[model samples]
Target: MRTALLLAAFLCGPALADRQSFPPVDEADRDPSLVEFRETLLAKIAARDVDTIVALACPDIYLSHGGDGGPEELRANLVLDPQTLSEEYREDADAMREQYWTDLENTLSQPGYFDDEGEFWMPHQWQITLPASLDAHLAYFVTGQNVSLRQQPNRDAPLITRISHEVVILRDHQSSAEYQRVLLTDGTQGYMHSDFLWPMTGHRAAFVKSDAGGWQLCTFVSGD
Candidate 1:
């Protein structure tokens, strides 16, 4: 649990015992320091507080998708000064900032974007690992058929459970294109064929921290 994140419930489940490891993140892998910064950043973002946002950001922030720089670049892009904008540039300027912030705000609401080093490490475009205990908040139903919750990603792995049609399979929010990793209510974690599940609205976050104790948000994105 974290100072800000204590507001949410938590989960505990078994690891997917599959051969093909799911690429999405997991609750077990999170860094509390990163999670705290994420929650605080989200609050500041909702309030549109630029000063506080920059204070928590790394001066040399890395934007993998957009401009590759730090606070200077982020502030330049996000601060939409109407008086400075030319008539023609006004529309695109506002839209660009809007889209950028919107995407980030959306991304930060999900989970499992951080790596072992307490740094954000989502290499893929869209991925989420459901929070360990918050499965009740978002889940997927085993659709149309009885699906085997496998111990591993492959078909040969041992079956953890036989899921029936519309059975609410609590997702760990960890995802891959082919197989989605999930957890049973009984605390058994495993993989479900991605095709057999349906996902709901979920939120996740990202971070950038240096060894010298600089903790801040790099970016945030949300997915299905």
Candidate 2:
């Protein structure tokens, strides 16, 4: 009876108003608690806290001196926790959805979306499908280049621009649509097309600059 009473008292104890939000410790500051850091990062992104992102991210986050296109472009790459998003963020998500749908509608309503290149296709803009399945989250790749990889869907154009954290592929005949996309870690997805992805049957995707650039051999579905 006494133990039960003491437990009840502990449960009913007064809440501490002075409880720290994030723990202030050496490890917390230096090592950065992953969960807490992720949460805080998402929260700041949701609120468009560009200053916080600039402070937290490495010096070469986007490689434009941390002040490239500012918060708007940064927010484009950010996905927030659905549970914690503010009403404004909810509205923003809705807007993004609306924009995507609008773009799709515009493309589909064209004179010949599937056949006519000049009618439906625009330079430097594309809507390639993501390679891997994603959850409720939506993602897209935008090129800073003018020309796409397709020379009528089966040839390589000139190297337009350098894509960071991305690999380029040369187009050739006998390429398959299934191998058109560049796979990503975390089972997410990336961009590539039959026009750009050089197919190698029974061989994993390899990065080679000039067919010889910064190359890294990857092992998918293999325990490394």
In order of appearance, the predictions have TM-scores of: 0.46, 0.20
Residue 18 error, candidate 2, Å: 57
| lDDT of model number 2 | 0.29
- The runs of at least 3 residues in candidate 2 whose Cα sits more than 4 Å from the true structure, single-residue gaps closed, are 1-32, 63-224
Give me candidate 2's TM-score against the actual structure: 0.20
Tens digits of per-residue lDDT for model 2, 95-169: 664553343233222221111221112111122222232320222222223224322332354332323222222
- Per-residue lDDT tens digits of candidate 1, residues 65-120? 45466776667656866656788787688786787777567556544444555566
